[model samples]
Target: MPKKRQYQHLKSFKPIAPVSPALSSSSSRGSDSNAPAKGVNELLSGLRRSAAGSSSASSPHLLANGPSVHPDLRSILQIPDTPPPAPRRPVRTRFDASGRRLPAGPPPPRSWVTTRGQDVDLSHRMRGLKLKDAPSDHNALPGAYLPGRGSLIDRVLRAIASDWEFQRAYQQYHLYFLPNHLKPALLRHIGISGGGVTLADLKLILLPPTDLYEQGELEADSHTTNEVSYLDLSRSLGRSIRLRDVTNFLVPPAPQVHDTHLEDSWDAAVDATPSPPRALLPNLTHLSLALSPDDAEGGSWRHLLDFASKTSHITHLSLAYWPDPCLAPRAQTSKVTTPQGNKIYYGGTNFYSHSLDHDWSEALLVLRKLSRCFYELEYLDLTGCGSWFKALMLETEHDHVDWAVHWGKVTDLRLYAGFPRQEDMAAAEQVAFAEVMETAALVERHIRHMRAGKGRFINVERDRPAT
Candidate 1:
């Protein structure tokens, strides 16, 4: 029985149920008291009433928020209705002098004043040579005929009459003795005879034979020792000839006989007669002497220098000899007096004492004397001389270290065959050659104020490197 009671007590029980909304709503509808509607239609009607109330209450709020819908929209609305116009610049004027303009008037023409302080027609003068008459075959005929059959004597006499014409014609027609073929003809044409002609005139003699003489060929000797066989043709030509041609004959080895006996014989033949009074070539601008090795042995250069001292106007001089030091004796004395009253004294040992110490000094004395006496020298060609000259001229140890200073005015120099062997065609030697060229250029540019073509060393063949 207890088990049965316990089982019935343990059994589950259901709770009381709540009333349904539909039933409540039906009750409310039926009662019609002051309660809200509960059906779908009433609910809809209540929502509509609430919506209408909400709309009425929020109408003012919507209007207040409507104006500020978005920040971008407000900025767009506030933008200016019209844009601003661009600025303008002022215009420039034409006639103002402040602005850059072309020159007002034409420029002055190029001009230069003449030496005579006159406004000469420079352009007209610069204009090329005007043809007096068109150069025709007829115009050249007279010049062509004059060379062969014209009377040269008559022309010379006529030229002598007019000094200006003579000077101009002399400068133009006083031909140099450059052609070998013309030498004998000229010498023959100008007969050798004793006249009032001085050696100065003889210096002007343009005997073509002298050019031949330079080429180691001379006409057969017509003179003998006892009598004057060959005429003094040089004197005759000197009277009428210009001295310019003598420069060519003054080249090295003139009267090129080597034998002293023969030289003496030739000298005697030329001046056989004991003439009372004869003028030496005082205006001799150029002179060359070829001394033999034998002649240089007995201090013969002193005698030669003595003879040279006589020629007061010898401006350019060249002394060349075969490779023989003895040919140019180096002698110095404390007191050396010439027959012409020119006295020289050596303060030191004589140059030709056969001592190496005084070699250069002695050579310098000779060169100094020559340069001092011949101040008008323009060119000095020392091609074949021995080292004695160079030792004196180039050595810097002596007091007269600047041996070539006197020759500063000389414009042209020809040094061939005798340059130091080591200096031949070397880069270092180029400086020495350049120095020489510089000196020449300075003279030509400043002193002479003229341009001239200078010779340069040209290698005949490529120099091969030593193995």
Candidate 2:
């Protein structure tokens, strides 16, 4: 090593003052008479003796080794035998991410660390599958997911990747149920477009159970737009989640449900409450029901139509093919086995609605019932609806329909003229247009009556060629 700077040039070491007062007094009294005197100033004065003669500090023979005390050293003091002082350390400085030096300050508050983030998972809200092995199809909805078996999502992700790749893959993975736990994450992943999600995107979302989800909070665009959430609750029953629970988060357009067979849910929705309106979705304004005309007269189908007739808040109504399949020409019809093992037929015993002429299907009767039930309806969407213009004109002569009431409040009436095959389309189109013109005349007549010849109150729209 190099030369020790001023560290080696010290007088010979001596013992410190004794800790025991009695021993110290006795030692001092004895050292004066027997041993050589060891004083502090004498040691220092002697060590500096050579230093005073040298013109420079680079002297090897800096200290003298002897017991002789300096006689001229007055003001002597006791020097304790201890190691030299430790070298001083440089002060540390902190800097921000932008390389700006931070000033000294106290540590951050505990709340800053403990506060929950947007990504903080609500363990209780998420329900995971209990598969013992990896599933064949990761995207497929699990047949069943039991509780208290640990998080299925986490277990599966860990099995496929290491810790570094874990969370990244989780963001990319497709979950079965749209968990309320990841709403913010989902919105971020999908991104915001327009002001909110359009009707097209609403069909793509996998709605979670009714109990766990909140409607208003789940609005994709954070605005009360017509972003309808459609759910098929026909397969789920007896679970903790009920259909009514789906209404908790409803926005302007209520969530659509496909549970046509459930009569109690239908009754519950329309039945009036004593105080706070017993309707599941109190703010519900739009509803689309999938119906089939073939069901028994006194069954759930009738009950659903009845319930729908009494509905008041729903201003926009759409008759759709949700609960049942579209009425397309087929060779054979499907059969359903009931709970009591009784097999109900589709084409054999059921009344199938199919015709080449202007014979309206029995299902179209729902439209008349809807018009009667929802007298104050503002919008009636029949874009995806089946045909009934011809039947409406034909039935008026037999049944006395209050035409003013049906077409009076209606501002937007979309009519779908479903034509038959290519061979008869020319003839069918001519008939359909004629019937449409006839229907328009009637709507105009009712409007004129309601307005007392002031102005028109309706827009009759037929199938326009898709761009």
Error of 1 at 16 (Å): 99
Pairs with steric clashes in candidate 1: 183-208, 192-232, 192-233, 204-243, 330-352
lDDT tens readout by residue for model 2, 1-467: 89867756787578766589888898888887897776998989987986776633333332222233444442264432333344556556587689998768754677764554322444323323224332222211122222222355544433332331333336333332345333222222222111222222232233333344577555553422223222222111112122222333232234445554545565567533334333423444555432222321111334444455445656665543222222321312667788999976543212344344333433345445655677766665543234333433334333323446554566766554433224445876666655655565564455446556543366766544435
Model 2 spans with C-alpha error above 4 angstroms: 1-277, 289-310, 320-368, 384-386, 393-403, 418-456, 463-467
Instruction: Give the per-residue lDDT digits (tens) of candidate 1, residues 228-282.
Output: 1111222232244322332232321223334434444644665344433332222
How many clashing residue pairs appear in each of the predictions shown? 5, 2
The candidate that achieves the highest lDDT relative to the unseen native structure: 2
* Runs off by more than 4 Å, candidate 1: 1-278, 291-299, 322-358, 392-405, 418-467
Give every collision pair in model 2.
215-249, 216-249
- The TM-score between candidate 1 and the true structure equals 0.27
